[model samples]
Target: MLNALLFDLDGTLTDTDALHLLALQQLLQEEEGRVFSEAEFTTHVSGQANANMCRYLFPERSLVHHEAFAERKEQRFRQLSPQLQPMPGLLRLLDFAQEHGIAVCVVTNAPRANAEHMLRVLGLSQRFACVLVAEELPRAKPDPLPYLSGLECLGARADEALAFEDSVPGLTAAVGAGICTFGLSTSQPPQTLLDAGAHRVIEDFNDPQLWAEIHRRLDVR
Candidate 1:
């Protein structure tokens, strides 16, 4: 049986991707005089660190400058936290999971401070059994370190968990960690997510048919 559910935070549980994009755009523009289209911006930092993103956007900028730019973006993200909205059906799902005695954790590649700030604003800091921050690992998504670390903290095994994510990198990380992966359409198309290794993909969290399928999987495991 699946004993736990691990979730990706930004695009999975909350609607903060737009805010994150805005912050990154502002930082890149002010520091490097460059404008990135939505596709360009997302493709650049899809699953990369701030420093790497900076280098990719402004190769001429010093590492120190890039670091400062990243800090500024984070500061702006903190300011925007109060506006963080939980994804549809999130509360219901969480409540159902808890009632069913399934442990839930937020496992993300976001910095610890950013993660805490967002969760606090969404009143979700205490909802999760564990919050695994990316900084805690030497590597993040697409590497399995974050999810593996989360499983360790939850005292759970791969077969005993299900992972919820919305992006290709997140799905890949969870699948690589040996967990069953469920993809959300909040960030990508259903086909894209499934192509990235999601066992199944849903258009919305509130879909009764999808939840039925998820429950079936959980029950059978």
Candidate 2:
């Protein structure tokens, strides 16, 4: 039986990817005189940890500089939070989880500020049992530590939890931790997510097939 629902915050729970992309594009232009294309953002920036993204995008910069850049980028993102929208069926899924007594946890590669801001904007600040930010963990997404930690925090085994993700790194983390993972398809192609080990790909929580799979999993349990 699924005892917990582990979710990725930015793109999975809320449609913040486009906002983030814009922030990154603006940041890159201001800081490095570079332009960040949407395809590049999807392929390189989305789903990556702040530190990793910084290193990848500005290898010549010092760690301190990268940290500052990340902070600025996130600040820009938060400024655009007013435009945030919850992923379709998010509230219904939360209600279902609540009615069924399933624990809901937010597991994200996002910084704590961004995570908190997004949740608050979606009016979901108090809905989750726990919110695990990657920076606070020993390792971030694509490493599985964050997802493993979320499962441990919920006192749920990987087999007893379902994870929702919207990026390759997030999928890798959740799947690596042994959780049944679903891709949100908000940030990457469905095939990319499937190749990254997602059990299924969904446009949002409203996908009937997602509910069907959930019912099937529950029936077996």
Candidate 3:
């Protein structure tokens, strides 16, 4: 039986990917006069570590500068947190999970402060049983530690848990942890998610019966 769920925070729970991209673009433009398109940003920086993402965008800058840039981006993101909204059916699914004795945890590559801000702004800080942030681990998504730690916190084995993710790195981490994962196509293409090891993919959480289907699927085997 599916006893727990690990979820990616940004695009999966809230539509904050665009805001994050915008913040990065603004920071780059203001600091270095560099313009980063959404496509390029998502392709190279999204789901990557803060330092790695900074290096990819500012290869000429030093590690210290990269950290400074990341800090500014985070500041901008927090400023935009008020605009955050939960994805359709996300809260319903969370409520259903809680009501049915399924543990729900947030396992994301986002920094703890930013994740907390988003959750608080969306009035969902208490919805999850745990919020495992990237800062809590030495490595982030695509490393499997975040997802594994989330399952550990829930006292659930990988085989007994499911993960919901919308990015390749998040999906990869969850799948690599030996947990079944479903990809939501909010940030990237569904095909790319499946290619990244997601067992299933869906466009969004707009369907009313989606939770029923998810429950049924997770309950089997």
Candidate 4:
């Protein structure tokens, strides 16, 4: 049975990846006169945890510096996010889960502030039963601790839950946690997501393929 729904906040619920990239780009340009191309972002940056991302982008920087830079990037992204909206069919999917008595939660690698800001911007602050942030846990995505913790909070088994993710780390983490994971191609390439262990990839929640799978899993009419 489909007992829980796990969602990765940024790109899975909404197309906020571009804004995140823009925030990082603006900060990098201001600090180092560098431009971050999309290919570089998709390959080397997207879905990474704040500490890892900052270290990768500024390897010479100290942990304190990385933390500060992450804060700045998140603040800029929030400022750029007032126009955010839910992904197409997302509300409908949430409704389905609600109707079926399926528990819903958000598990993200984003910092707590960023996650809260984004969810509030999308009017979803009160939606999830649990919101798990990587920084609050012992380990972040690509390690499964976050997702495993999410399952614990929901009192759901990994095989009985479904996860929606838009990036490699998110997908890898959920799959590693033993949840059946579906990839939302909101930011990364579908094939890359599949390669990262996504059961299937879709452009958005509205994809017919996603609905078919959900129906097959839940055995609902």
Q: Which has the greatest TM-score?
A: 4
Instruction: By lDDT, rank the candidates, best first.
Output: 2, 4, 3, 1
lDDT of each: 0.81, 0.91, 0.83, 0.90
User: Which digits, one per residue and each the tens of the lDDT, describe model 1 over residues 26-45?
Assistant: 76678667776778755667
Each prediction's RMSD over C-alphas, in Å, is 2.2, 1.4, 2.2, 0.9
Q: Is 1 or 2 the stronger prediction by TM-score?
A: 2
Q: Candidate 3: how large is its RMSD?
A: 2.2
lDDT of 3 by residue, 70-171 (tens): 888999989866767788878777877877788999998888888889899889988888899876798888888888889899999998888889888888
Report residue 53 deviation for candidate 1 (angstroms).
2.3
lDDT of 4: 0.90
Stretches > 4 Å off in candidate 3: 206-213, 217-221
Better of 2 and 4 by TM-score: 4
Question: What does candidate 2 score on TM?
Answer: 0.97
Please report how far candidate 1 places residue 173 from its true position, in Å. Answer: 0.7
Report clash pairs, candidate 1. 1-221
Q: TM-scores of all models?
A: 0.91, 0.97, 0.93, 0.97
| Clash count for each candidate, listed in order shown | 1, 0, 0, 0
Residue-by-residue lDDT tens digits, candidate 2, 59-156? 99899999998999999988977757788999999999998889999999999988888888889999999999999988999899999999999999
Clashes (candidate 2)? 0
Summing lDDT over every window of 10 consecutive residues in candidate 2, give the lowest-scoring window. Answer: 212-221
- Which window of 10 residues has the lowest lDDT sum in candidate 3? 206-215
